[model samples]
Target chain A: MFAATMAAVLVTMILALGRAVLGPTTYDRILGVNMAGTKTVLLIAVLGFLTGRPDFLDLALIYVFLNFIGTLAVLKFIEHGDLARNAGDGE
Target chain B: MLEMTDLVDLALLLFLAVLAITIAKQRNLFVVVIVMGFYSLVSAALFTVLDAVDVAFTEAAVGAGISTVIMLATLLMVGTEEKTPSQPRILPLLAVVVTGAFLVFGTLDMPHYGDPQAPIHQHVAPRYIEVSGDEIGVPNIVTSVLASYRGYDTLGETVVIFTAGVAVLMLMGQALRFRQRDGDA
Candidate 1:
């Protein structure tokens, strides 16, 4: 059952990669990457069950936090064109 | 002899291959960064399947997380679309293909996945697994090995991360100063 779920996740990852590659807009690529990150968290958690190592879930949690920060940073950089922009500056 | 786990691993490998090809072909810097994140995610999953949970953790954190943010920050400094290369692509392509072929050849000599008798499994790994419970008393062997056995290496890694954070802050500080100067003018 875990294997089947892993296979499904792999399929989604491929689809996301395809979107990232075929992107006509930057937003499409970013969204695809975000989707892939979400699937990856699931994949890690499922693999933990498959391998009978529940400890691996720690990795999944780390990925979750990191992915959120990364996506937000990307969007901020894209919107502002500078990461060092003053926080008081209105968006 | 192939198990369900093996099938999943193979499918993930296939996905990684597709992601690599797409990343190579994409010219847009933004798209490339996004595809690279996918590549890192798949690679981390592959690491997990290989039973290297610690490796997977670091890869997911560094590869999918920090690298993506850093790349985006770089892209903000440098525009999104890649500038057209003045030089021909043939030489670089040949160099990459040759280097890749050599890498593949190198991997051919590597022990099969999860081989019990592999040199790595034979050496410190067994000792760590055996002694970690009694010595370090950590349930997670990875944590024991990283924190106790390999303390220096982990410390070095932490120092590097700290230095990077400091460098980024310094750059931002300079930028802020420049902006203030402009405003004053």
Candidate 2:
């Protein structure tokens, strides 16, 4: 059962990777990478249970945090062109 | 019958190789860096499948997280178009192929994965697994070994990361501000 689910997730991850590689727009690539990160979190969670170590969920939780932070950071850098600028400085 | 873990591991490695090739082929630095983050995610999943949870965690945090941010910040200073190298790629490609071949050759004498008789397992691993829990009072032996048995190594790693962060700030701290041309998505 776990194997089947993992196979599905891995398949989807490949699709997401394809989306990233074939991207004609920057947002498409960001979305693809973001989707891949989400699938990886799922893969890690299932992997924890499959390996008989449910504590692997702890790592999944961290991946979730890191993935979100990374995506948002990329978007912010892309939009603002600077990570340190204040929000009100539009000029 | 091969285990499902092995299949999953193989697929993940394949994805990693594909990502590497695509990232190399991309001229857009933004796309390249984002795909690099995606590559890290696949490798981290592979580490998890191999039962290296700690390694996966660090890879996700450092490889996917901190490294992506640092590289993107670098792009902010340097711009997103990868510069075309003036030199021919033939010699460097030859060097990489040779080094890769040497690496493959070097692996010939290593024990296969999960071999119980491997020298790594024969070393202090046995004692750490058996006695460290009792001695260090940490239920997770991996934690005990990393925090207690190998305390100095962890401390050194901490110092190295700290130094790297400070040095990066010293060098690129001011130039990272928004350039007028960076606003187009």
Candidate 3:
């Protein structure tokens, strides 16, 4: 049962990598990488259970937080054009 | 006789190689940076599966997260398209190929993963496993090894990260102050 689920997760991860490699537009690539990140998060969780070391879920949770924070930071950079822009700069 | 985990590990490593090649072939700088993050993401999963959870955590946070953000910010000002070299330098390519060949050659004699008879296992690992609980009183052997046995190494790593953060802040601080002065004028 764990083997089957791992296989499924591997397939999804491969597909996500494919999309990241072949996506046409920048947005397409972003979406693909983001999907790949999501799949990676799932892989870590499923792998934890398979190994009977689910105590490492803290690592998975950290990935989830970092992934969300990274994607948000990138999108905000894209939307606003700068991560370090001061409020007075806009004024 | 490959176990299920070994088979999956091989498959994931193959995928990582393909991703690396694709990243190398890409002329789009933005895509390269993002895909590098994806590569780190997958590799972190691989590390976790290999039971190196702490390494995986650091890889995901530092490799995938912080570096991606920093590189993307730098790329925004540097332009998205990669600059093409005027000509392919065969000497550099040859040097890289030679280095890669030597690295692969070096791996040929290494013990298989989790081999009980490996030299390192015979040396310090056994002692750490046997005594770290008593010495460090940590339930997690890995934590004991990292924090207690490898205290200096961990301290050095922390110092490296702290220095890097400080250096970045220093550089950025000068620029921000300059901009503020310009604004005042």
Candidate 4:
């Protein structure tokens, strides 16, 4: 069951990677990479279960927080050229 | 007998691959981003079927939530079209395909699914299942490996996050302060 699922995850990651590679725009590539990161987190988690190691849960949790913060920071930088933008910048 | 989980996992994987191909072939950028989000969600579901709840949660959050937002924000900055190039780079595409093929082939050596005698099942896993109650007392073996035997790796992973944060700050932190100073001037 786990093997089948892993294969599926891999297939998705490959597809996302293709998007990341052949993206028409930078944002499209970023989106693909972000989705890839998300898939990676799940891949790690599923692999953990398949391997029967629950300790991987900690890594997965930490990864989730990091992925979120990292994406936010990157987006902020791209949108406004700075992570710490002035309140008025959003408008 | 085909279990429902098996069918769902297979279907989702095929769907994700098709979506990816569609995104690659399409000229539209916005549609690619949206499809990518869907791809991530499906992948997350597949992870859960593998019994990796933690991974599924992270996938849904980062793939669907954070990544989509970043892509949109980036789109706002850089318009949604590619700069005209003299020629397409076929080499990069070929390289990626070859590498992916090799990886898939390598996984063939892995133990068959759910086999009780698989090395993974016979080795450290059984110990954890048996001794976790008396030793670390954690019910989840995944947690035990991450927090205990492989603690150093976890710390390294944490450091990686810290570094990424600092790097982002370094890139944007200075720019923000400079903008403020310019405004004051």
User: Best candidate per TM-score, number?
Assistant: 3
The Cα error of candidate 4 at residue B3, in Å, is 2.9
The DockQ-derived docking category for candidate 4 is: incorrect
- DockQ of each model vs. true complex: 0.70, 0.83, 0.73, 0.08
Please provide, for model 3 over B59-112, each residue's C-alpha lDDT reduced to its tens digit, 9 standing for 90 to 100: 999999999989988987898787874466799889999999999999889998
After superposing candidate 3, which stretches have Cα over 4 Å from the reference? A84-91, B85-87
Q: By lDDT, highest first, what's the ranking? A: 2, 3, 1, 4
Per-residue lDDT of model 4, residues A1-91, tens digit only = 8867767777787777666666666677667766776776776677676657745666566556655665665566566655456968665
Q: What is candidate 4's local distance difference test score?
A: 0.70
On DockQ, the stronger of 1 and 4 is: 1
Candidate 1: segments with Cα more than 4 A from true spot: A84-88, B86-88, B136-139, B152-185
Cα error, residue B139 of model 1, in Å, equals: 4.4
> If you assessed candidate 1 against the hidden native complex, which CAPRI class would it receive?
medium
**Residue-pair clashes per candidate, as listed?**
0, 0, 0, 10
Which CAPRI level is candidate 3?
medium
Write the candidate numbers in order of decreasing DockQ: 2, 3, 1, 4
How accurate locally is residue B86 in candidate 4, as Cα lDDT from 0 to 100? Answer: 38
> Least lDDT summed over 10 consecutive residues: which range in candidate 1 chain B?
B80-89
Candidate 3: residue pairs that collide:
none
Which regions in candidate 2 have their CA more than 4 angstroms from the true location? B85-88, B156-185
Residue A74, model 4: Cα distance from true site in angstroms: 16
lDDT by residue for model 4 over B1-185, one digit each (tens)? 86545665676677678767766765555555566666676677667657667777777778766787677667667765655633658998999999999999998998877778889788788778888767876777778888887889999999999999999999899999999999999
TM-score to true structure, per model: 0.82, 0.87, 0.89, 0.64
